[model samples]
Target: MHGALPATLILLAAAVLAVVACRQLKLPALLGYLIVGIVIGPNALALLPNSEDTSYLAEFGIVFLMFSIGLEFSLPKLKALRHSVFGLGAGQVLATIALTLPLAWFGHLPWAASVALGGALAMSSTAIVSTLLNERVELNTPHGQQIIGVLLFQDLAVVPLLILIPALANPAGGVIEALGWATFKAIIVLTILLYYGQKLMRPWFHMVAKQRSKELFIINLLLVTLGIAYLTSLAGLSLALGAFLAGMLISETEYRYQVEDDIRPFQDVLLGLFFVTVGMRLNFATLEQQWPLLLLFLVLLIPLKALLIFGLSRLMRSPSSVAWRTALSLAQAGEFGFVLIALAHGHQLLPPNLEQALLGAILLSMLVAPFLMQKRDALVRRFVASEWLNESLNLTQIAVQSMLARNHVILCGYGRSGQNLARLLEREEIHFFALDLDPERVREAAAAGDSVVFGDAGKREVLMAAGLSRAQAVVVTFSDTHMALRILSHVQALKPGLPVIVRTFDETDVDKLKEAGAVEVVAEVMEGSLMLASHVLMLLGTPLNRVLQHIRSVREERYDLFRGFFRGATDDSDDPSEQDQPRLHSVLITEEAASVGKSLGELRVAELVEIKAIKRRNIKGVEPSDEVVVNVGDVLVLLGRPARLAKAEARLLEG
Candidate 1:
C-alpha cells in the first residue's frame, strides 16, 4: 500500500507537469499525457508499473468521454447538418475504412483485425481541430461547418464500432454468427434502455434536483451514469455504450447541461489517465525495431487521409479553398483513434510491433496537425487561385460601400449592440458603415437597407477599405478584447488621432484596452449594474433628478471621456452659452519646452487650464498636485475651454 501511494504520487506529479508544459507550449494536453506515460511507463523509466488496476481505472475515461459525446448528440443538430454529417462525414469514414481494409488484409492481417485497424484510422482529432477552428473564429465558415459535421458523425460511429470490435475478437461461434448475436444484443439492450430510460431519466433527475443539494445532485448524476453503464456490462455490452446511452437519455431533459458540467472534471482526469495507459502500451523496443514501419504509417496517414478528404469535399461541391481547409483541418489522427487502437490491442487483434507502430504514427501526426492547420490559409492561397480573387472582390465591395460616405462612423461589428447604435445614429441623421463576419446577417441587414458589409474588421485591409481615413470615429461593438486590441493597433498605425471606442463584457479589460490606445471602453456589466441600481433606487422613492445626477457623477468618475466632450463640428447645435464648456487637452513636455523640469506650481497655468493628470511612460496620475514635478517626457493632461487650452500650451512651451 505504501509503495502504491508513491506510484500514485508519481503519476499525479507527472500528469500535472505534462499538462502545464503542454499549455505553455500551446499544444493539446492529450499529447502531454501520452508523453508522460511513455517516459514513466514500465517500458521506459518504469516509475510506475503497468498494473491491471490502473488500466481498469482508465477505462472510465472512455465511459465519460462517450457520455459527453452523447450529451452533444442532439436530433435537431444532426438533422440540420444531415447532408454533411451523413453524406460527407459518412463518406469520409466509410472511404477511410474501405481503403484501409484492403491494405491491412494485403499485409496478412485477418479480416477482423483489418476492420479494427480501418475503424481506428477513420477518426480525426476532435479536440485539436475544434479548438483551433474556434480560436481562429472559423467555426461558422463553410469548411468549419463541414469539419464539425464530419467529426460529429465520427463520434457517433464509435458506438457501433465499439460493439463490433469486441464481437470480432471472440468468433468462437463463427465470425458471422458472433457478429449477428452481438448486434442482436446491442439492439435489444439499446432499445430497452432508450425506450424506458427516457421516461425515467427526466423524473429521476427532477427528484434529485428538487433536493437542491449540489452534492446530492452530483451523486445522483454519477449513479445514473455508472448504473446504466454497469447494467450494460451485465448484459454483455461495453460500459462506454451504456454511458453513451445514459447521456442521450439525460440530454432530452433540462439537466443535460448541468450533468455535462458536473461530469467534465471526472471525464478530463480519467481521460488523461486513459491516454497515459495508451502511451504505456507503446513499447519503445518495438518502435526502435519498427522505425521504418512507423515512418511508412505516418506518411500513409496524413497525406492519404488529406487527399481522400479533399477529394470527398470537392465531390460534395465545396470550393477548392474550402476543400483544402477541411482536408488540412482533419488530416491528423484523433484521440478516439487512440481509444480504438487501445481497444483493438486489448482484444488481441493487433500485434505488439504493429500496435506500437500505429501509436507512434498517430502521435506524430497529431503533433504535426497544429502546424498544418496554421499553414492552411497560406497553402490554400498558394494552391488555389480563386482565393485571391475572392478576397479582392470582398475588399472591392467594402470600398464601394464606403466611397460615398464622408466623416461617417465605422462600426466594427453588426451584432445586436452595433444594430442598436446604428438606429441611434440614423435617428440623429448620422451616416455609419457596419462590418460583420456572418454572411447571413450581412445579407439580411443589407436587404433591410443597412449600410453593412461582410468583412473581418480585425483585418488591416478591411479597415482601410472601410475608409478609416475618412471616418470620424470607429466603434468596436464586439466584446472580444484580443480582436479589439488588433483593431486598435491598426487604427493607431493608420491614424493615431482617430477616436476608437471599445465595448467589453466587463471592467477586467478596460485598463488593458485603454493602454492599447482606445479613446474609451464601455463595459457592459458595469453599465448593466449601474442601470439595475438606478432602477432599484427609483423604486425605493429616490427622486428622478437625484438618480440621474448620481448616475452622471458615477460615469464622470469612471470614464475620463465622460468628464468633457471633445468639440466637433456638430457641437454648434448645442446652446450658445455652453460653447465655452471645459474640454480636455494633452501637452507633451519635450526637451525644447520651458516646463520640462518645472513643478506644476512653477508653470502657473492652473488659472487658465486645470492640470488633470500627469502621464509618463504609460502610467497616468490623476489630479496631479502642484508639488508634482514635470519631466521632459511627461504629458500634462489639462482641462479648459478650447481657447484656454491653446493659450496654456503656448504658455508652458514659451514661458
Candidate 2:
C-alpha cells in the first residue's frame, strides 16, 4: 500500500507536467498522456509497474468515454447528417477495414486477428480534429459538417466493434456461431435495457431530483451508471456497452445537460488514464528495431486513409476542395484505435511487436495531424485550380460591390448583432457592406437586397476588396478574440487611422482588443447588465431622466467612445438650434501643425471646444490636463458645436 501511494504520486506528477507542456505547445492533452505513459512505463523509466490493478482502473476510462459518446448520441442528429454519417462515414470505415483485412491475412495473421487489426486501423482522431475545427471557426463550413458527421459515425461504430472483437477471440473455431450468439445477446440485453430502462429512467430521475440535494443527485447518477455497467458485465457483455446504454437513456430526459456536465470531469480524467495505460504498453525496443514497419503503417494510416476518404467524398458529390479538406482533416488514427488495439491485445488476438508498431504509427500520425489541418488550405489552393478560381471570383464580386461605395461601414460578421446594426444603419441611410462566412446566411440576406458578400474578413485581399481604404469604419460583430486580433492587425497595416469597433462577450478581453488598435470594444455582458439594471430601476419608479443619466455615466466609465457621439443628420430635435449642440470631433496634430508643441492651456480654444482626450501612438483616450503638452501626430478628441469645432481645428492646425 505504501509503495502504491508513491507510485501513484509519481504517475500524477508526470501527467501534470506533460499536460502543462502540451498546453503551452498548443497540442492535444491526450498526446501528452501517451508520452507520459511511454516515458514512465515498465519498458522505459519503470517508475510505475505494468500491473493488473492499473489496467483494471484504466478500463473505467473506456466505460466513461463510451458513456459520454452515448450522452451526445441523438437520433435526430444522425438523421439530419444521414448522408455524410452513413454514406461517407460508413463507406470510409468499411473500406479501410476491407483493405486492411487482406493485408493482415497476407502477412500470416489469423482471420480473427486480421479483423481486429482492421477495426483498430479504421478509426480517426475525433478529439484533435474537432478542437482544431472549433478554434479555426470552421465548424459550420460544408467540409466541417461532413467531418463531424464522419466522426459521429465512427463513435457509434465502437459499440458493436467492442462486442465483435471479443467474440472473434473464441478458440473453438466456431467463429460464426460465437458471433451470432454475441449479436443475439447484445440485442436482447439492449432491448430490455433500452425499452424497459427508458420507462423507469425519467421517473427515477424525477424522484431523485425532487430530493433537491446535489450530493444525493450525484450519488444516484454514479449508481445508475455503474449499476447498469455491472448488469451488462453479468450478462457477458463489455461494461462499456452498459455505460453507453445508461448514457443513451439519460440523454432523452430533461436532465441530459446536467448529467453531461456532471460526467465530464470523470470522463476526462479517466479517459486520460486510459490513454496513458495504452501508451505504457508500447515497447521502445520493438519500435527501434521495427522502424521500417512503423513507417509502412504510418503511410497506410494517413495518406492511404485520406485517399480513401477523398475518393468516397467525391462519390458523394462533394466539391473537390470540400472533399480534399474533409479527407485531410480526418486522416489520422483516433483514441478509439488505442481502445480496440488494447482490447485485442488483452484477448490475445494481436502479438506485442505488431501492437507496438501500430501504436507508434498512430501516435506519429496524430502529431502530424494539426500541421496537416493547418496547411490544408494552402495545399488545396496549390493543387486544386478551382479553389484559386473560386477565391478570385469571390474577391472580384466583393470589389465590384464596393467600387462605388465610399465612406461605408465594413461589417466583419452578419449574425444577429450584425443584422441589428445593419437595420439601424439602413434606417439612418448609412452605406454599409457586410462580409459573412456562412454561405446560406449570405445568400438569404443578399437575396433580400442586403449589401453582404460571402468572404472571410480576416484575409488581407478580402478586406482590400471590401474597400477598407475607403471605409469610414469597421465593425467586428463576432465575439472571437483571436480572429478579431487578426482583423485588427490587417486594419492597422492597411489603414492606420480608420476606427475599428469590436464586440466581445465581456470586459475580460476589452484591454487586449484596445491594445491591438480597436477604437472601441463593446462587451455584450456589460450591455446586458446595464439594460437589466435600467429596467429594474424603472420598475421601481425611478425617474426616466435620472435612470438615463445613470446609464450614460456607466457607459462613459466603461467605454471611451461613449464619452461623446459625432453629430449627424440623424440627430434631430424639436428646436433647429439643438442641431448645434455640443458634439465630438477629432483633430490630428500633424508635424506641420501649429499645435505640434503647444500645451493644452496654450491652445486658446477652451471657449470654442473642450479637449475631451488625447490619443497618442500606443495609447488611446488619455484625459488631457491643462498643463499637458501636445506633440506631433497626437489626436485631440474635442467636444463642442460644429461651427466652434471647425474654428478649434483651424486654430490648432494653422494658429
Candidate 2 least-lDDT 10 residues? 563-572
The TM-scores, one per candidate, come to: 0.88, 0.90
lDDT for predicted candidate 2 compared with the true structure: 0.89
Writing each residue's lDDT as its tens digit, candidate 1 over 504-526 gives 99999888887777778999998
- lDDT string for model 2 (1-655, tens) is 8968988999899999999999888799999999999999999999988899889999999999999898999999999899999999999988987887786657888778888888888888989999898777787789989999999999999999999999999985788898899999999999999999999999999999999998899899989999999999988899999999999999999999999998889888999998888889899899999899898999878889989999999999999999999999999999999999999999999888888899999999999999998899999998689999999998999999999998789999999999999999999788899999888899999999999998888899999999999887899999998789889989877876567899999989888888777888999999999999999999999999999999999998988677556654445667866776667876778889997778878987786878876667735646678788888867777888778999999999998
Please list the C-alpha lDDT of all candidates, in the order they appear. Answer: 0.88, 0.89
TM-score of candidate 2 to 2 decimals: 0.90
Best by TM-score: 2
Candidate 1 similarity to native, TM-score: 0.88
Clashing pairs in 2: none
Note each model's CA RMSD in angstroms.
3.7, 3.4
